[model samples]
Target: MDKKEELKRRQADIEAMGGPSRVERQHQMGKWSARERIQYLLDANTFEEIGAHVTHRGTRFGMDAVQAPADGVVTGFGRIEGRPVYIFAQDFTVLGGSLGEMHAAKIQRVQDLALKSGVPIIGLNDSGGARIQEGVDALNGYGEIFKRNTWASGVIPQITVIMGPSAGGAVYSPALTDVIIMVRHTAQMFITGPQVIQAVTGETVSAEDLGGADTHLKRSGVAHLAVDSDAEALDGVRRVLSFLPQNWMEEPPVVKSRDPLERIDETLARVVPDDANKPYDVAGIIGSILDEGDFFPLQKGYADNLVVGLGRIGGHPVGIVANQPRVLAGTLDINASDKLARFVRFADAFNIPIVTLVDTPGYLPGTSQEYGGIIRHGAKVLYAYAEATVPKVTLILRKAYGGAYLAMCSRSLGADLVLAWPTAEIAVMGPDGAANIIFRREIEGSDNPAETKAAKAEEYRQQFANPYVAAGHGYIDAVIEPEKTRGHLAQALMALYNKQDHRPKRHHGNIPV
Candidate 1:
């Protein structure tokens, strides 16, 4: 055969994927084909395919008669929004997108290129776990991929999109990535299937209930963002990358500011109510301060008491960690601690400045928290804040009490500039709790104990619970009005833009997991 004719045949073979019928099956399941997803995600004609003609050497089960196109995975480099990125999309049509020796090699090659180039790597996982027919070779493939995932972590951003079943060992790869975007109804991730669980533990739960996108997003905190379709999941990936830099060595991409830096919102003054116990949506405060009210929330469905996400203040990308008083009274719990610590670490690693909005009463107190190791978990927040070398600017919105105050990036935890609002109640604890202990004798011996207790609590609040007390000791750098929050943050972030911080020389601090 002529060389040109052979080239045409090979090109047609690769593009065909598993076959027309299998591709149709993928569409019927409400998911895009592997190539289709790539085409949609990347810029027009920007993808440069690598390892396109690779094939598996599996010689078990049906023996060597099987033909696998692209070894069940499409790997290449492309431009997403004009920025270069490495991507690998598993073709579920080919042998169920199962991982084999060559399949893993293709993914590893892309991972290596991404790490070396200092560009982000994205994995579109729609696999049916390892190719069991290939035995240990398939298992070794997973191990190789995991090693690269670990090596590339923090150096370059790694994102995963779970579009279909990612059960058993398949879930770990996505877990290792920086963010996991899952498609609802079609995607699921679990260590064990319902059949196995029912057989061993007698728990008869469906796949959706066990590892659906909502379960992971709201309960397990495994999935960062869950979308209704594959297109939205891909869009979520792009949105997340917009907030982060191409690599950890560089600062996050700064864009033109849409909102005026000097813009002040009078509504912010009323966002925090006069009553301390009243709940408020902290998203209001976040939206008002960010550029054009644009905030890309991370793990929004999980650990909602603590809100952490990426946003721009004056067009400079920054990480915002705020307390949501609407949930658990903004108190730190195990899940919230994990969420806060991870987000802070990600921001610090990527050279993004940290903006923490504090309003927690304190740590959530209960036997569940204690038995669940809240001390170890809570220490993660303190460790993350203290260990971060980025420019840390903390704002005390309302209640900042006890250890939670310190954990929320206080002046003591190496915050570069600490700002507080007039309504901020920065104290050891709430005034009522403190007054009861400090003035116990007077209150018990008083003619009207209730009246005396109220008077002492009021006195305590006036004397020590407010921001001025913290400002007096130089713990707070500035106490500004709530209306001036955006202006204050914009200026503070600008001033600290070139902020330099150094840590003690060590291999690495032992962060509590």
Candidate 2:
């Protein structure tokens, strides 16, 4: 064949991707092929594939006859919103999208290039774990990829989308990534398959029940986002990338938003009910302040008590952490603590300013929480907020009592500015609790103990439970109207935009994991 014809033949063979039959099977399963997914995620004609001609080197058990196009993976650089990113998609049609020596190498190359290029890296995972035919070489491939994932952490943004089965060692890579997006009904991730579990423990469970998207999102807190279909999952990735910068050294891309910075939602003034015990939806408050009410929440189903996600204030991307009073009285628990700490750290690493909304009564009190090491877990929130050098603006919406007050990015925890509404109660503890402890003897001796206790509680609230008490001590920088929260936050974030805080020179402080 002539040289030009030979090039066309090689290109056609690679594009075939495990023949037309498997491609059709993939479509029937409601999952896009590897190339198609990359195409859908990136801009039109922007993908520059890196390793398309690479083939596997497996020679055991008649492996020499196998033709694993691109070694079951496609690696390349692409543009998401005109910003550079490196990606690798496992071609499920080729060799079950198994990660052999060459497949892992292709992924590693992209990872290295992403780190070197100072851009984000995305992994479209759809594999059946390590290739058993390749044995230790396959395992070694996973080890190398995992090491790079660790090294790249906090340096560049890493996102993983589980489009198919990720079993055994394959699940670790996604777990290590900054955010994990999974497709419902089509994707599953587990350390062990159901057959193995049945053989060992005899607890029968379907794969969907064991590690489905809902299972991970709501139960295990493994997945950050879960979607209905492959297309939605890819779109979810694009949305996440919009909030992040190219790397840790850069600021998140800002869009010129039409949402006015001075715009105030009058309903916010009445958001907090007069009865402090009554619960309200914090999402309403979050929506009222963010630009166009666009808040991209992560791990929404897992930690319902504490909301953490990305949004924009005056078109500048900001990480939002809020306490949901509707759930567990917005108390911090083990899971919520982990969720808050991880999101704060991620935001800090990517130079995204943090905006915290506080309303938590305190840490959840129970034997389950204490036994689960809530002390250790809660310390993570303190450590993360203290360690972060990014611009931190905290708004005390209602309840900010006890250590939970300090944990929610208080001025003591290095927050650059702290704002509060007149309804905010910033105190060591709730008035009722403090009153009971302080007036115990007086209440016990009074004719009507309940009335005396209530009167003393009211007195305590009048003395120290209001925002002016904290504002008097200068802990709160300003006490603005609830309706003006968006304006205050937008102005504070802009003023602190060039914020520079330095940590002590050291290797790194060990965060309480």
Candidate 3:
């Protein structure tokens, strides 16, 4: 046979991909094959594959009888929109997308290229963990990938998409990435499976309950974005890249916006109800103020009381952190504090401006919060705000009570400008608690004790429950109309476009983890 014809025959065998039936079954399971996913994720005709003929070196345990095309992985470079991104997609059709020495080498090559090129890298994980036939070499392959993930952190953004199982040591690579996107029913990530858990710990659990997308996104905060399908997850990755820069040294990408910055939104006035006790979605407020109603919320399922996301302000990327009164009254808790601190530090690291919307009642108070080291954890938010040199603009939307106010970028925390809505109440605490402490004796001595306490509480509210109190003392820069919030923020962000922040001499301050 001719050499060229032999090459064509092998290529056709590899493209058949364990035959069409397996690929169809994979589709029936609601996920695409490795090559199909990469094709779907990258722009049309943009992909330039690096490794397609590499096969496994394993010969033990009947591995010698199999032909593992691409060693269960497809590595290449592609464009998301017009920007370059390197990707390594594992093909589950071949040996369960198992990792051997060559497969790991292929991934490492793309990662190395991404680092040298200073472009983002995306990993589409769908594997049954390491190939057992390769033994320690398989283990070493995982170790190499982990090393690359750690070394690439904060340099080139690493994004992981879980389209299928990521079990055992395989889950750690996604954990090391800056952002993780997972599909609802098809993806799972955990150290051990339910069968192993039952054998080891006598606890029986389903796979989805143990490490599913909802489990990670809502309960554990392990994954950042969870969606209904692989297509949406891929889109999520592209959207995230659109906001972030390829590297830390450069400013985040500034997309052109046609949304009118000066347009006043009266709908914001209704999002925050006149009834202080009624809860409303903070995302509505964020939507009213951001450009084109675009708010890419981080951890939407976790620590919802504190909303963190990236959005554009007058075509410039900015990080938005706000309080959601709908959950636990928007009280600062351990998870909420950690979430905000991490987001704040990330935005600061990448040179993104911070715009904070404060409406918290205060830090959550209870034996559980204190026992959970709320004091230590809550300090993280304070430390992040005080240390950040990026342009910070804060607006007290309603209530900013106690130290939580300072924790949320108060004027004293080096905020470039601190604006407050007319409805804002920047006080040490809410009126009920303040009145009970200050007028206790007077209320107790009155013939109608309940009536007297209510009167005192009302008196306290009238005295200290408005933004004018904070503005009078220069704690707030200005009190603006609710409709003018978008305009004011655009101008404030514009004025601080070239802000320069200098820090005292130090290698790096140790933040309490």
Please list the C-alpha lDDT of all candidates, in the order they appear.
Answer: 0.93, 0.94, 0.91
**Tens-place lDDT digits, model 1, residues 270-327:** 9998988799999999999999999999998999999999999988999999999999
lDDT of 3 at 16: 69
Clash count, predicted structure 1: 0
Better of 1 and 2 by lDDT: 2
Q: Choose the strongest candidate by lDDT.
A: 2
Question: What TM value does model 1 have?
Answer: 0.99
Give TM-scores for every candidate, taking all chains together and pairing residue i with residue i. Answer: 0.99, 0.99, 0.94
Clashing residue pairs in candidate 3 are none
Q: What stretches of model 3 exceed 4 Å from their correct place? A: 1-10, 504-507
- For model 3, residues 104-152, the per-residue Cα lDDT tens digits are 9999999899988989999999998999999999999999999999888
Error of 3 at 49 (Å): 1.3
- Residue range 1-513, candidate 2, lDDT tens digits: 899999899988888897899999999999999999999999999999988999999899999999888899989998999998999999999989999999999999999999988999999999978899999999999999999999999999999999999999999988889999999999999999999999999999999999999999999999999999989999999999999988888889999999999997999999999889999999999999999999999999998999999999888999999999999999999999999999999999999999999999999999999999999999999999999999999999999998999999999999999999999999999999999999999999999999999999999999987899899999999999998889989999999999899989998899988
What ranking of all candidate models by lDDT puts the best one first?
2, 1, 3
Give the residue spans of candidate 1 off by over 4 A.
Answer: none
